[model samples]
Target: MKPPPFSYHRAGSGEHAVALLSALGPRAKVLAGGQSLLPMLNLRLADPPHLVDIGRAEDLRILRRAGDRLVIGAATTQSEVEYSSLTAAVPLLAEAVGYVAHPPIRHRGTVVGSMAHAAAVAELPCVALVLDARFTVLGADGVRTVAAGDFFLGPFRTAVGPGELVAEVALPIAAPGTGQAWSEFSLRRGNFPVAGAGVSLTLHHGRVAAVAIGLSGVADRPVRVPSAERILLGAVPDDELITRAAAAATEDLEPRPAADPAAHILPVPVAPVPGFDYRARVARSQVRRALTTALARAGGTR
Candidate 1:
């Protein structure tokens, strides 16, 4: 089905987009790459009265390093990031973006758009959360920075207000001696993951000094599992320790039934295996895989 009738305005600049959003309020939606939004619009899942196209907003296409952080503009396409040298600054992000979708889709999908879409299983948000990224949002009241942890409220929900637009996202460059990895389980290439994990670790004197673990497709939002991190801090990187940390990652999660049995969008089309238990298991495995990979990269013995 075609999208509902709506007026389209190509924003001349970031300021113009903000103005349009403020004036249109809840009725207007900002269109970046439109990879996610277009699907929703086509499905009639979203029906806004107006669309402010910010794809041409040059200011929002920035990709640069500021101090110790890599700042990405909301309009920067995933493909731009994937091929940029800046990806080396955040390896986890680079690895995760590869799993977002096919090359064609990535060419048109914006990283900020994925975060703003707030999909529970989206790779970018999980990576952002693990890296403690910050999102800058613009509104009529000016700008406000929201931590990645607090930016996502739930599936398809975020701190972005009706009239506010996410202007940029800032991810801290991994400190020296830090290692990061991203792992996920999907039915096939270019499909949404069933469960995924991103891990960043720093080793000090043969022990885990600092670690961060973020999970996707296992909760209402992308989540950093402090419990799991706590289990690995100051510990030796070993199979036993990694196993315990992986278990901690999913120990407290409550499993829920799958949404639809008839939908083939996911690998498992039945509730029998796609329920909470299944996701938890996948989450555990991914956490283990990510941690192991990160540990190896950090020069720790597996």
Candidate 2:
């Protein structure tokens, strides 16, 4: 089905985009890559009255380093970042972006769009959460930075309010001696994963100094398993300890129900991987694998 009628306005700049959204209020949606919003519109799941296209906003296409952080403009495409040398500052992001759809989609999908889309199983959000990325939102009043941990509220919902748009995202550069890894279990090459996990580990004197574990596809939104991190802090990397941390990461999770059983989708197959128990098991396995990889990269042995 075609999307309902809507007025399209091409924004000349980031400020212009904000102005358009402010004038149109909640009825307007910002179009960056149109990868996420277009699909929703085609499905009749979203029908905005006005679309403020920011595709030409050069200010929102920035990709550079600021101080100790990697600043990515809201309109920057995933593929652009995926292939750029700037990703070296945040290797976890580089690895995670590879899981986002296919090359064609990544060529047009904006990184901020994926975060704002806030899909429960999206790879970017999980990486952002693990890295503690910051989002800058532009509005008529002014701009404000929201931490990734606090930005996502629920499925497809975020802190972006009416008349506001995400202007940029900032990911902190990993300190020396830090290692990161991303692992997921997707049915197909470009499909969303059933369970995914990312880990960032900082080693100090051969022990886990700092650690962050982010999980997806097992909850309503991307989640950080601090409880599991606590288990590994200051501890030597060992198989027994890894097993305990993985168990802690998944012990309290309640897997989301599968999509409607009768959708009869192809390529987009329904989840027949049993129920909560099976998903939790997958989550555990992913957590262990991610931790192992991250630890090895951090120069630790398991």
Candidate 3:
């Protein structure tokens, strides 16, 4: 189905886009790559009065290092992230981008768009949360920063207010001896994970120092497994520790309900758990795998 009637304006710059959105209020939608918003519009889930296109905004497409962090502009495409030299500097981003929808979609989808879309099961947000990334937002007032923890509020929701557009994502450079791992349970390649895990550990000597774990596809939002993180810290990364952490990660996640959607009706999709029991089980399994992989990378003994 075609989207509802709307006015479109190609913005000259980030400030120009923000001005349009502020004037239009909540009735306006900012179009970056038209990846997430277009699909929602076509489905009549969103019917904005106007679209402020910022695809040509040069400042929103650049990637560079700022001080000790990697600053990536909002309109930067997923393909850029997948192939970035920054990913080599920090492989967590590369691993997360690998799990995004296939090449063509990635080529057209913007990183900031995905984060702003705020899908609970999306790989990028989970990775960002695990990395404790910062999100930069542009508004009528000025630019402001929001931590990953505060930015993601719920499925398809964020803390961004009207007239605000994401400007960039900032990732801190990992300290020496830091190790990261990402894992998911997708039925097929390119589909979102049924349940996914992102794990990062800082090692001191042979023990875990600080640990962060983010869970997806199992909650209203990507949730940080704080209990599991505590369990992993200062502990020897052994089978026992990994097992305990995995158990803690899946202990209370209630699987979401699923409708047997007709394949023809909903062509785009993500990993869906078979049932409540199965989803919980898969969450546990993914946690185990992710933590184990991260521990190994951190040079922990088997």
Candidate 4:
């Protein structure tokens, strides 16, 4: 497939990129690592009139820690974030990054690009949701912060305006006794998960303290299962409790079977509209696996 013709510009700085985008308006698109966008271009899914390449914008390639929070420049690559010293402080994010595609893909894929791409099926964004990460966006009106929960509005879509560029992401330091686990189930190695969960919990006085469960590939957006989190709060981890939590986590998903009528002959669940009911079932299974792993890491039931 060939992409539609477009003008190209390489920005010297983040500010320059923003200005160019602002001036170009709706016809312009920003290029980071070209991991996701380039594919769209190849398929003619996106035919923007101009392409602004910010790959050489040095400021967006750095990672730093500011006071109590860790700041990641939007253009920072997945490989950089995975091996960063600061990311080591946040084990969940680090582990998740290690699992993001293969090494080759990670080398060229930028973290901010993935977030801005807003693929509902991605894992890191779900972790971002669990950690309450905040995104910094630069626009003509200056800068503003948007919470991860609010930033991702739908599949491959975000709250970023026409000219706004995501500058960085801010994550708060985890409280003491806090542990996190990220796990997923994929049909093949290195493939995106069919369903996944990121669990963060704080242990207080020998009891469940705070819990945040973020799920992916089970809905239109990364969903936080508050009901399941609430169940684990102040309670002990047990088989029955985990089961109940898994159900809660998948309660809203409606997994349907495959669309091809002939696919039903494969002896697998199939349904319409992604089979929300059946997807929820698969989601339930994965949630249980994730919760068990998370509990074990948190020292297993007090």
Clashes of each: 0, 0, 0, 15
Rank the candidate models, highest lDDT first: 1, 2, 3, 4
Q: In candidate 1, how many Å is residue 26 off?
A: 1.7
lDDT of 4: 0.78
**Which structure is stronger by TM-score: 2 or 3?**
2
What are the TM-scores, per candidate, against the unseen true structure?
0.95, 0.94, 0.93, 0.90
lDDT-better candidate, 1 vs 3? 1
Report the lDDT tens digits of candidate 1 across residue range 179-297.
Answer: 89999998888888888999999999988899999988888788888889999999888989999999999877656567622112222242233677788899999999999999999
What are the per-residue Cα lDDT tens digits for candidate 3 across 12-88?
88889999999888879889888788887898878899999988898889788787788888778989978888765
Model 2 scores worst on lDDT over the 10 consecutive residues at 260-269
lDDT, candidate 3, equals: 0.80
| Model 4 stretches with alpha carbons more than 4 Å out | 254-274
The lDDT for every candidate, in the order shown, is 0.87, 0.86, 0.80, 0.78
Selected candidate, larger TM-score, 1 vs 4: 1
Q: Extract clashing residue pairs from model 1.
A: none
lDDT by residue (tens digit), candidate 4, 157-269: 68998988898888877667777778886666776666678888777775778888988777666889988888889987788998999889876554534452211211122
- lDDT measured at residue 38 in model 3 versus the true structure, 0 to 100: 86
lDDT of 2 by residue, 1-302 (tens): 78888999999889999999988878899998998788778777678999999988999998999999999998899999999999888989989999999999999999998898888778898899999999999999898999999998877778999889899999989898899999998778898777789999999999899999998877778899988999999988899999999999976766455651211111133346445566677888999999999998888996
